[model samples]
Target: MASSNTTLAEASNITTMAGRSNSTEAASPYSFHFGMLLNPDYLLVEAQVIFSALSIIWLGAHASLRRPPSAAHAKPKNGKKKVKDVQFAEGFTASDAIMLPVTAAIVLVGLYYALEWFKDPDIVNRVLRIYLSTVSIASLGAAAGHGLDIITSLVFPGLWVDRKGTLYRVDSDHQHQVKVGEGDVETEVVEIKTPFPSFLSTLPLSHGKIQAAWEIRNLLTEEWTVRLAAHGLGLAEFSIKLNTLLGFLIAISTTIAYNTTKWFFLPNLLGSAACYSSFSLMSPTSFSIGSAILVGLFFYDIIMVFYTPYMITVAKKIDAPIKLVFNTGRGVSMLGLGDIVVPGMLMAMALRFDLHQFYHKQMKLEPIDLVSELATATPGETVMVSETQYRRVKPTYADPEGQWGNRFWTTKLGSLSPVSIATSVRAATAFPKPYFYASMLGYFAGMLVTLTMLLVFNHGQPALLYLVPGVTGSLWLTALARGELKDMYGYTEDGSMDVEDVIVEVDSTGKTIEAVKSTAEEKGETKDNKTGKEAVARTEKGEGDYDVFLFSVTAPRRRAPKRD
Candidate 1:
């Protein structure tokens, strides 16, 4: 490892010493990427990769050892055992399959154009164009994020975050009486909203924020809206004056900032983080989905990295915030967050699947189908959903190479129920957790291997080319050996709920009509609501942090400021 680092250093030093106008053009295996890091003179990216892998392992361990529902709501489905086997969609629908390529095209175009225009010297008023491009690309990226969520929904209905699936209702506030003046007691009511999570909405991660340049964006949007309203209302005089003044003010500020500072970081950081966060936390509802992402991205990375020089060219020239950057005094090393996030997410879900298995065994709860009639339940009460599960033994693919074919596990699914985000948080604690850790460990190991090879070969390699096999292969082998093959295959990170329809029964004689029973009536809606609310408040307070399952699982260590 040390020798590898030394090799990279010696090569970099030799290049620097040979200083000529064509230094960068004197190409080798690696090309200079833009953004904050200029050369691969440091091991920061490798360190970050290792750090994230370790974090994943630790999270898995913690879930196994520490997390379990304190009380498993003993409610059985139709007085039967709960089936932990997860149901999965056979394949993606038509629209979703098509969008996958559309997504790839959009990203490629954005990357090419972002880098091209940013570096073009002949372009007039470069900063203004940069801002425009940033907005356009960002909007496209957001659309892409939304599209991924839609794809998620196509497989597992209730998993998307941008939609509201959780219901948080307000009860009476908690009032604290305090003495204000000598004679008056001031009562302050603490407002509270109780979120009741259905099994479905609990798995995905989300955050809310706006950064520096975000302010400028809002300003531009509002100005355009105000101007449009004025003109539409026949206030042409006002619209002209206002639009001109606002435009002038924006132009001046943008020009100064772009000229004075490194303006690229804003969009760079925004785009990279957004993609990383969304993809990393978007858990797969089936083995197929995870496989699709890994297989797709693996080839995507390879083709972009080795087959064509475009990716490196853009990365080197843009010098944008698209990567998580760490600069050493000599040079910088950068890692694309995707390299950590995509595989890391799949690893995280495997861990959760293990955790759930642990609880089922420890508590001796029987497996029942997740049949859903989501009426309010008492806090700490596990509501059992008994849904239909259709499993079939199938070959991986039709191939003449093998005698018959490699067999795999798969399933079919119905619609999903609306679940609360809070349920996911609980499910995290209740289930037992594992190689999601091993895979994470493999990720760290693979990353080190990748870096070492980079040093030896002195050329760039597509990281996923190493990573896909390292993580996925390790998980596959481990699961097979441990007899957890069914567990892994059945592991769907779906927040799916189901309420069975049963309004009629028939004997051998004639059909008998039966009235549908109301679960709310049995539980007493009022009491159920109060109990559910109280339970929610307690869980919210006691649970403390659900983010243990979030990006933090592979969160990078905060680097200290670069040396002078």
Candidate 2:
């Protein structure tokens, strides 16, 4: 993120003005320099740096650990269902990379001109704040929910379900007939079973009651649903689950407190949340796309910071959560959101790529065909139907149970534990992360250099100028050293690896009765479908077909006489 020294200059100007007004005691230059060196703002800057780095690391870890919605879900067991994760509709493309700098330049120039014409930055800031704050509220809420889950998992490992499973809402009055078999044979109809209330209330301290307070938390968490009705309705609805609602409330409270008291930490918290949410919502998808975006922004940052004043001017003038501002007791030290997000996206991609390599090269789990058999009985006849399908196995790394626990507590003085660490280092370093680690090292070094230059030169520096090269160079170097250039180039987050065969069973009326085995199931287990048919499904090595099967009772009619 860009660190600006414009505030330092302003602080100096104010000091000079104050001295001119007093014209009495002259402060010693040595004392002034010492005070600057010991300024509490320096600690604040360092804290922000650490906070930004940790946020980036967590963002990348989240991207790598999260599985697709279909893969994350588990069968409904005792009224508990898994919560699905939220993801962006589309991944960042190469075209987006190409246009990023151009689009940013246009916005910067437009904002600059608008400021000049209006002669007031507040007008622009107010307009932008309205839109940005609205978005930030949602983003902050989601990020907070995710962070809470992470903390809960780390502290109370295995205490909660891996997917944060919650109780499903029961509708006792709603019922549907489910067909049991294919139409060629005898068909049995069964009523859909309603799930029992969750036993969470049976848990200690009314934990179950706490969980029952929320329903369908995974609906919006996985993806956004859009609805349009032409009749008398013209509205768009977005849903937030319990955790998300809590986060939303927290964000709203923060906004209110900041507006009333002008607290600096509030904005920083909001800005950090926005950055984390941005990483979750969008990613470069691949190293190449990430590199292209960073390189483009590299030049853009240089031009905007060194050649023009729009960057700093806007950063200083805007009174929103777009930038992190630390009150240095003199003025403020600023870090623009762009400085963190642009390079942070690339770092996140690096982590994801590392995970990709780990799953393919280290785990090396092969796809297996799952075959299912179904039988239907009709008048004096029986028909047997067989279907084959394949599903991607969920990785151990994706499992939340004991995944984020600190193992250091198990280490005894007489013995050393393999994963002895006070932090979640065991989980964080569970997979080999050469590229991710390298990029992080580079990022830390670049930040140090940026801050050093800011002090030595006493001027604002474009952070991307250092950060882009540091991250991209480190990644390329690591790739080259590991002889993974080809793999890095070929790797993409297109959901192909995450795809699994889904078997949908339908009734004689062509209505879908149930979906069977969308994800991997334990071997040799018979899965009971809604139609009351127990299908023996097992994994094998062979070609498989997956599709919807509809059974009808009526036989095909004989061909009609020539259609003269």
Which segments of model 2 are wrong by more than 4 Å? 1-44, 56-64, 68-86, 151-156, 159-241, 362-397, 400-429, 499-564
lDDT of 2 by residue, 218-271 (tens): 222222333333423333334334455567788887766766676658877877
Tens digit per residue, CA lDDT, model 1, 1-564: 112122111110001001111234334344434331223434554565456445533433332222222123323433343322223323333343345534754665566676576666234235434564344343334333333333322332211222333222211111111112212223222221111112322434332221222222222222121222131232221112233344344434544454457654443334343333333335455555675667676776666666755565544444333344443444344556466555665675566556556544433212224367554567666666675322111111111111010000001123232222323323433323355657766777777666665554445556677877887887888788888887667655443211112233334553333424336534446545787678768756875432222111111122332222
lDDT of 1: 0.41
lDDT of 1 at 193: 15
Query: How much does candidate 1 score in TM-score?
Result: 0.43
Top-lDDT structure, candidate number: 2
Worst 10 residues of 1 by lDDT: 402-411
What Cα-based lDDT does every candidate model obtain? 0.41, 0.54
- TM-score per candidate: 0.43, 0.61
What lDDT score is found at residue 527 in candidate 2?
36
How accurate locally is residue 7 in candidate 1, as Cα lDDT from 0 to 100?
Answer: 16
Cα RMSD (Å) per model?
A: 21.0, 16.4
Model 2 clash tally, residue pairs: 8
